[model samples]
Structure formats: structure tokens, C-alpha cells
Target: MSYESITLATIAEKTSISRPSIYHYYDKKESVFVDLIIQEYREWGEQMGPLLERRCSQEQF
Candidate 1:
């Protein structure tokens, strides 16, 4: 469900959700984009956290 850097029209078309529904959740397109960016960053951080700790442990050796 990734739609980064895409137009609202494209997102609406892809999700089969209306533009008004999207706005209802996000208030504005920029808010939706920002929320998407934050979600990606959070997911990346979660995925990398363990790997980063492993690297740090190795470096401490």
C-alpha cells in the first residue's frame, strides 16, 4: 500500500477509495504524504533496529 510521490488521483484510482475519504482521514494531501513518509521511516527503523544493534555488538568486539 505504498503510494509515495504519487498524485492524489493516482492514489485514489489505485486504492479504489474516493478522494473525499482520503481527505476525511488526512485532512489534506500533504498530511497524507507526510503520514506516509513517517510510516515508512518508522517501518525502516523497526527493520533496521536489530541489524544496527548487531553491528554495534560486532564493533565492540
Candidate 2:
């Protein structure tokens, strides 16, 4: 979905969390999106870290 169309209600429904509970962690929808991106990056880094640490050749990489 486009960022412009995203609302707190949209996020709440998608996440199965209430709007009030969302407020406890974020003051606005943008904050939720920012946090989501940060979380995705962290997870991606964690998944790739071990593979990068392995002694694989460049071709295997």
C-alpha cells in the first residue's frame, strides 16, 4: 500500500493491535513505519551476519 493511504487504523487492523495500544509505542503512523523499517534491517543484518562470517570463497558468496 502507498504511504499516503496508511493510517493508524490500517496498521492496527493489519497487526491485530488496537489503536490505543499503538499510541503507547508511537505518536504517529510515520513512527510505526520507521520502526518497521529499522526492524526489517536488523533482521536482515542478523540473517546475513553469520553467512558473511563463514570462510566461503567469493564465488560461493
Candidate 3:
């Protein structure tokens, strides 16, 4: 879904978290998106870091 269409209620419903609880952790819905982006990057690095460290010939690369 588009960012503009994402509401706090939508996020809460998707996560099964209450709106008040989400508010306790995030000032706004955008903050939750920022956290999600950071989490995705961290996970991506963890999955790709090992592959990047291994030696590979030009063709393999």
C-alpha cells in the first residue's frame, strides 16, 4: 500500500498491537516506518555480509 494511505489504525491492525501501545513506543506512524526500514536493512546486512566476505573469481563475482 502507498505511504499516504497507511494510518495508525492500519498498522495496529496488521501488527495485532493496540493503538495506545503503539503510541507509547512511537510518536507517530512515520516513526514506526523508520524503525521498520532500519530493521529491514539490518536483516539484509546479516544475510548478505557473509557472501560479501568470501573470495570469488571475476566470473563467479
Best by TM-score: 3
By summed lDDT, the worst window of 10 consecutive residues in model 2 runs over: 19-28
Q: Which pairs of residues clash in candidate 3, taking residues 3 or more apart in a chain or in different chains? A: none
Q: Tens-digit lDDT track for model 1 on 1-61?
A: 4546676766677889998777668655677678889999999999988787764555663
Provide the lDDT at 10 for model 1. Answer: 68
lDDT of 1 at 60: 62
Error of 3 at 27 (Å): 1.2
Worst 10 residues of 1 by lDDT: 52-61
- Candidate 2 per-residue lDDT, tens place, 1-61, comes to 9989988889999999998898788888999889889999999999999999889998988
Q: Which stretches of candidate 1 lie over 4 Å from their true place?
A: 1-10, 56-61
Count of clashing residue pairs in every prediction: 0, 0, 0
Q: After superposition, how far is residue 39 of candidate 3 from its true place, in Å?
A: 0.5
TM-score of 1: 0.62
The ten-residue window of minimal lDDT in model 3 covers 21-30
Cα-lDDT of candidate 2: 0.91
What's the distance in Å from true for residue 35, model 3?
0.5
The candidate that wins on lDDT is: 2
- Which candidate do you rate higher for lDDT, 2 or 3? 2
- For every candidate in turn, the CA RMSD to the true structure comes to 4.9, 1.4, 1.6
Pitting candidate 1 against candidate 2, the one with the higher lDDT is 2
